[model samples]
Target: MASQKIATLVLVLGLLIMPFSIASYAQIPCNTVYNDLYPCLGFVMGGGKVDPACCSGFKTVLGLAKTKTDRQGVCSCLKSLVSDATDGEIKNAAQIPKLCGLNIPYVISRNIDCSK
Candidate 1:
């Protein structure tokens, strides 16, 4: 009975700590970026103006990227999303920061070396 109780306590402690560890591992959640930018798919595809919400979302993601690793993660996430987009769509995505009056340091492109 004591062994079972100790095992249960260990399991509970592991469960409690799991979320904090995962949260620390991924400082920026990519899903947030996807949710924020999904509204801009039409604009990115070259059919319409960027939505205010999209710009807001982009800014939020940009603000959250406070480190080099975070920035690279964002870039990698974006690259995967844009892989299926047309050349024009990719171009529009690359230009979003400029058009939105934001100042992102790196251009959004699949060709970018995220490791840097």
Candidate 2:
């Protein structure tokens, strides 16, 4: 009976931790980019060295890039998105999406300028 109870406890613990573990891993992309790029650019940023918690934060900024009405926040999110991108890709203008306008072309370009 004791052995069975221990097994049950282990299983429950594993189930509880599984989602959190997965979410942490998911944040690796953002974290890696932030750590690498921020130092060179002179901006202080960290997602705890690419652990799972960073991934949860990653989604928030990514979602902001897609549909947030706050234009300034959207521009700020760009640095996070491209922070992990390869060096060659960074210079390529076509690769970056233009967050100008729905129709009239507002051109919110300055907010995302992380380049030196």
lDDT against true structure, model 1: 0.67
User: Could you report the Cα RMSD, in angstroms, for every candidate shown?
Assistant: 14.0, 17.2
Model 1 weakest 10-residue run by lDDT:
15-24
lDDT of 1 by residue, 4-35 (tens): 43543354334333333222345765565576
**Which pairs of residues clash in candidate 2, taking residues 3 or more apart in a chain or in different chains?**
24-52, 27-55
- Backbone Cα, N, C clashes tallied per candidate: 0, 2
What is candidate 2's CA lDDT for residue 46? 16
Q: Please give, for residues 23-72, the per-residue lDDT of candidate 2 as tens digits.
A: 13233233333332222221112112233333443344444333333333
Model 2 weakest lDDT span, ten residues long: 39-48
| Stretches of candidate 2 exceeding 4 Å from the true structure | 1-69, 93-116
Model 1: residues with Cα > 4 Å off, grouped in runs: 1-25
Please report how far candidate 2 places residue 55 from its true position, in Å: 25
